[model samples]
Target: MNLIFHVRSERRVTFHPYSSLNDYIDHACCFHCRDGDWWLAKSLLTGDEGFIPCTFVAKAHSLEVERWFFKDLSRRETERLLVAPANKPGSFLIRESETTKGALSLSIRDLVAEEGDVVKHYKIRCLDNGGYYISPSITFSTLQELVKYYTRTADGLCQRLNAPCKAMLPQQPWAQDEWEIPRSTLKMMERLGAGQFGEVWMGYYKGRQKVAIKTLKEGTMEPAAFLQEANLMKKLKHDRLVHLHAVVTMEPILIVTEFMCNGCLLDFLKTEEGRKLKIPKLIDMSGQVAEGMAYIEGKNYIHRDLRAANILVNEMLHCKIADFGLARIIETEYKAQEGAKFPIKWTAPEAINYGTFTIKSDVWSFGILLTEIVTYGRIPYPGMTNPEVIRQLDQFYRMPCPEGCPEQLYDLMMGCWKEKPEERPTFEHLQHTLNDFFIATEGAYEMQP
Candidate 1:
């Protein structure tokens, strides 16, 4: 397998694996993200006819090249990736037909190689409907060298993965000494939303793939705690949790994930009346949230940050739980003692004082999500501070459903906020109830109530 690396600078484009001179100059200049500033040219290797060339510049996306391309597959399946002779080592191939247009994703992963342990990764995606190219003769490189080439470039690169590129000269070939991706490279990384770790940016791994990169803060024991959460996310396999596409131990620490165009559910809730949603549609959307929550709880994981804002939607408005930085994995038979507390406004009363993290704690959070849906995505405790919300929880509190809130739905929320954890309904029960509630409130569907 052959892997091509692009060294972009204001001066010229450099080709690795030394392919044809014409193909080198003819950089298709494939750009990533929105601004149209990015571009990469691919060339078949001359030394090895099969491998192709693809470049990596910085962008708001694509920082997690390793995770975005290689982490999710089984070892056996990963080895099956038909790499071209010029591609990188330890990388796999993806057939175009395997993915969807709405979620155009491809990858190269599972490099067990060392530089003495250097693993080079490369990934490609065709812009138009022109089918994908899965080469067989690929080569390999190390992430260390790839990072060096990225830095020594010209004006650096621009963001906007989908941004149109200025047409470049036809094909040409050039090669230069290794360089670094640069300290300012952090400036080029795209913001990937936030979590307990801090804001994430899009970055590159082994000079390939478009991915959401997450960054966290520094403090005593913070790294250890962060890795614990990251490792847990790595081991998880539910469609509900925002997928941890890949994890890297790069110096400052970085995480890469699949980008979700719909932003977060908190943002979507603000537009409940938008064309993409109606009452029935909204209820169904909320149903997915419960389904995801139930899945996590089923695995004995407690989502401490269960709220509308923590939920995310993709281009199709499909809901997925996110921000596992505050999650806890409970043993199958685990049970907490008294005097434990979680998020009060979103937590069951029993959990607040007893430190109990039962599945019911999630149900309490789900109730708050219900109010968010009923109120067109309003915060559960509007105008209430953390202490104030806690004060209310101390009094057997529940946020009231809006004026036209359906009675059945109101009853369900009331059950969820019951002072005793045991009094809450299971997610499975609430899921069915929400469906029945939707059917009962069909008239409201048209009224936009």
Candidate 2:
């Protein structure tokens, strides 16, 4: 069975049987399967068949890709969809009729493939009018191509996919890489936290390896977006950054990472053990966060949301930056999203007024995080609503330095909250300053008579 798939990237495929000059220059082909590293298929565009590489294409989900023509369906609803347009059979009879625009939908769950001697199939359907149809018989692998055939012009689907011309994928396909641990290997344990995106659970991998399991909230996000974020997170590595161990995409999407025993920094600080932490210890925690931020800054990434609640602490008192679900990669700068939500209390003045976000804005949030640490998890801009905090900041009001916070550290916080983005210190500078404070405090303790 030949199922429809879409080209994810542009590539030059070779025609082995017919090696004419014309065929070599513009051989067009839709993907079939892995003939080792090459594709074996035919192209509807040129009626030419050839071998393209696996990197050029990906399977497209029918509902999402065929939005212009088809809708999702369950088996029970198929008859209803076909008969809905007509009060009786005579007026809108779509089956075996011609020269009419009566459209009908069908839901089918047919066995489509065999993987390692196991047959599998996906639920799919098509939409059709009495005369014309939108299905595999139309001879287009993607909706973009199908639309182009009808209109004799490019359509929005082509623009939306934005297939790159170059082979921009990583050398190793993510599925076959070392990190792709089988879903069977993970055992779900106690629930840790719950949020809009998903739930976090303490889990065990391979019976002994403890890990944090984050499952995507059902129907909350598209599979493609979730997988994209997972891919990005797996590429990043650092001692102070949460390490992704594996991802399970079989049924309920799950992301496994190092389990931070101490939980979020804010909650940890509120605990009895947290209350006993001295200033030097707090500084160390902040320093670890800065080191992580430094790595992210150097990589030209923006963590849009950076607050104490997003920082995870381990049993060793090590802080690791977590929750990159909202993270974005920016080359030089990024424009603000039209309706993006942000934590107002921790947000910088510029990020609030304008929609611009930069590493400097993250610096502003880090300053607020410092307050959370110093105050032993006190909420920033306490006693003020979100709008009130914005108004106060506009009037040059700042949070009072947390009690017992050293003068040097408070001054550093003030610098981070500067109105001008360029005036704020880079994470590298913040890390060094924190190290100095840590060293000075240690020396003073040692000098006590």
- Best candidate according to lDDT: 2
Candidate 2: which stretches are off by over 4 Å? 1-182, 250-252, 438-449
TM-score of candidate 1 relative to the true fold: 0.53
Question: For model 2, what is the alpha-carbon lDDT of residue 170?
Answer: 19
Candidate 1 least-lDDT 10 residues: 158-167
Can you write out model 2's per-residue Cα lDDT over 1-449, one digit (the tens) per residue?
A: 66555544433434343331122222334555655555566665565665544544445543232322333332212222222211112111112112223323212111113311111111112444323234334445543554445344222111212111121221111123546568888899899889767799998876756789998866655667777877887777787898777787655688888788889998999999888766756876898799999999998888878999899986556789998877778887777878877889989999899988899999999999999999999989889999999999999898877889989999999999988899999999999788667444322111100
Across 1-449, the per-residue lDDT of candidate 1 in tens digits comes to 32334322233333334332333322222222222222333333333221222222222233323222322343222222222112333333222222344222233322222212111222333335443321222211433233233224312121111111111222222111211223333332566466554676666444543445666555412545566767777666555567676554444555555556566787776763233344544566677777777787677777776887878776445677877765768774235535433456776665666566667878888888888876777777898988888788777566766665767677888888777777888887876676455334223111100
- Candidate 1 Cα outliers beyond 4 Å, as residue runs: 1-188, 192-197, 202-208, 220-225, 271-276, 332-343, 435-449
| Clashing residue pairs, backbone N/CA/C < 3 A, model 2 | none
Model 1 per-residue lDDT at 337: 38
TM-score for each of the candidates:
0.53, 0.58
Model 1 error, position 143 (Å): 52
RMSD of 1: 17.7
Each prediction's total of clashing residue pairs, residues at least 3 apart in sequence or on different chains, is 66, 0
Error of 2 at 320 (Å): 0.9
